[model samples]
Target: MFIRLPRKLFLFYVSVFYLIGIPVHAENNTAPTGSFKSKACMECHKKNNPLLIKDWRSSAHANTQPITDCVACHGKLHQAAASSSRRDSTCIRCHGGKKDPVVHSYTTSKHGVLMQLEKRSYDWNQPLADANYRAPGCSYCHMHKAGHNVSAGIRDDLMDKAAEKKVREQTRIACLDCHAPRYITRLFENGERMLEIGRKKVREARSLIEQSSVTFSDDELAPARAQLVKMQQHLTNVYLGVAHQSPDYQWWHGHPALDGDLLRIKGFIGELYRIKK
Candidate 1:
């Protein structure tokens, strides 16, 4: 049987601290270390936490299936996590296996690539020790049974509703997980849109660079180049932005193209007019 690697499911909380009016408490509210499969179980989840009741009573995941309880997907709710792992063998009991396309696609992507590499090379990893040999599994996002004091993490905070909506629209995965193909497609579309806008902005600035490049020798070129450099930097930062602190992206993603364009244009102007080849 094949399994897919875990994907990032992000939710945009318009409210940074929806729990600002609330408190952050750490209680051993992990229910009896058993399954959440009964009305009693569901009630218990909501009962202990007034806020859980309020938040989930209106959640689609609450009563996702009337016949099947939350345990059907989330696993034994109150169990002591049974080891911090991303095992999905149990999940495969319901949503994975050789026939699942998500399983297939994941096995093909980088996430899956890691698993295969690890499995083949890690003779010590001859078999998955727990259902969680996979890191970052389904439960990490959806059906998450974490927290105390009746909470819904970021959902509690409030932010710009429109921005939140845009985030969701742009991200069909809805923060939990998107079906396999859809996830890839959504990413491509997002990148395409960004690249499009970025290229357009680059073009707009290129004309200015061209004009400045021609009429200026090194003296005039210095200041004009500085201005162009600033504009280029601004566009690069805006379009290729990420939250991570990584140079892999800065040189490869953010700067290469911009720098290349500038050098090429500068060379062209100088040579075409013999300003300073």
Candidate 2:
């Protein structure tokens, strides 16, 4: 017969081993990224708040980046306790809409919509891995594989064929845990086709912009360039839409929006030609 240790005892042994395995550095910003900072964090939190220390120790952030500690996210300056919204803001700092409207697109998705609608009723105390909420949030899918390793599920460079193929396989594996294999394959096929269509529309818009640039002065081509930006944004929306499984983004905000921008740029190109003539 196998006898299992209690969860607390298991954690205690793990923590003890962790303490022995890692070297502790003196508190200083000059040492390295997380070396000294993590040690400093562990020193205080390990005694006063061992549970938080345990969570961070087991996280990917700890192992991957040499323990991405408190200072990495919270900063060196201590302050009063923040609101509940702090965690969301911290996540958005890196994953937010700086380069793309990732958060915005998520808001338009079904998961996001449902999360917004039903988040209050959810047990906020439950760990993210439990998937206890009625609907998924940013953490649900992104952090599904590993809690602190949020980027585990996110594949960044979709343009590389090899990388894309890998992403497809990884996504299929993750989705299959909850969905049928056939359904996952169908969705992947559909999303790829939709993205291809969106890319073509963007290419057409770019071609029109290039044509306009030859004849029109910088001032005259401003509107076309502006429209191209809009087209690019729509293309991004399409990507976000497909990844998030949001039909509104894939259709209305993605494809049709790209179409509108393309046509407007074409109109500008025609206007420039007429002026040239």
Candidate 3:
């Protein structure tokens, strides 16, 4: 008999070194709409990296990255009339173009999918998350904040040009930000969900063995099929965009269970399928 593992237990076997899961359940998905303070972030960042401004000059966020910085999305809304949810429709407005280079690739990403269908697909009502720091999106990752320590230093070691201390630190911080508590929590959660998918896939493949020893009937198999399909839905919803259509993720992370062999993935992506690709 093949080995069987439960979702929670199986996930432990496949998580990245730093990932860990946290359970969260919410029914309401109201958006946040508060104008948080941004003058502070702007004050120092403007002086630190002049070029940073250029990146946003013609970009969507620049036009409306929320002058309130992180708070704009995480906090609350209080203006001319009253409070309101931060509608994601605003984000989709300029980023909806499929052929537009800057946002085209991102829109097709899982994050894009989540953002687009957040209200309808899952519980999007802003929840406390029992999280100390509110989750930040495109803005927090790119913008600077008050008391924002800047260790940006010269990377002459790599880039011939001297690195702007502020810019470098912000970049480093961005990576570290992913490795933080929230990052680990998210990965572990994804892993746990994947483990269930992995189990369902195994069951599906076994059913195809067509051996005397094989046991499940069509009616009995219906549930597994449904589960696996749900997992694939998640595959498209969650993991498809991280590395783009890279061979490794499509294979190791996405394909194996979808098709019995990883080669199917490699063939689909072909060469030049690495992340850097």
Candidate 3 Cα misplacement greater than 4 A, ranges: 1-98, 119-137, 143-168, 171-277
Question: What residue pairs clash in candidate 1, if any at all?
Answer: 14-158, 14-159, 15-157, 15-158, 15-159, 18-156, 18-157, 86-132, 87-131, 87-132
Tens-place lDDT digits, model 2, residues 50-123: 76666556556676654556666656544422223233445666665633468777777777778778877776
Q: Work out the TM-score per prediction.
A: 0.33, 0.63, 0.26
TM accuracy, model 3: 0.26
Q: What is the lDDT for 63 in model 1? A: 41
Positional deviation of residue 100's Cα in model 2 after best superposition, in angstroms: 9.6
Query: Which portions of model 2 show Cα errors greater than 4 Å?
Result: 1-101, 121-133, 147-149, 152-163
Lowest lDDT 10-mer window, candidate 1?
Answer: 148-157
Residue 76: error of model 2 in Å?
Answer: 10
lDDT of 3: 0.38
State which candidate, 2 or 3, has the greater TM-score. 2
For residues 219-266, what per-residue lDDT tens digits would candidate 1 score against the true structure? Answer: 655644564565465444423232111233333545565555556656
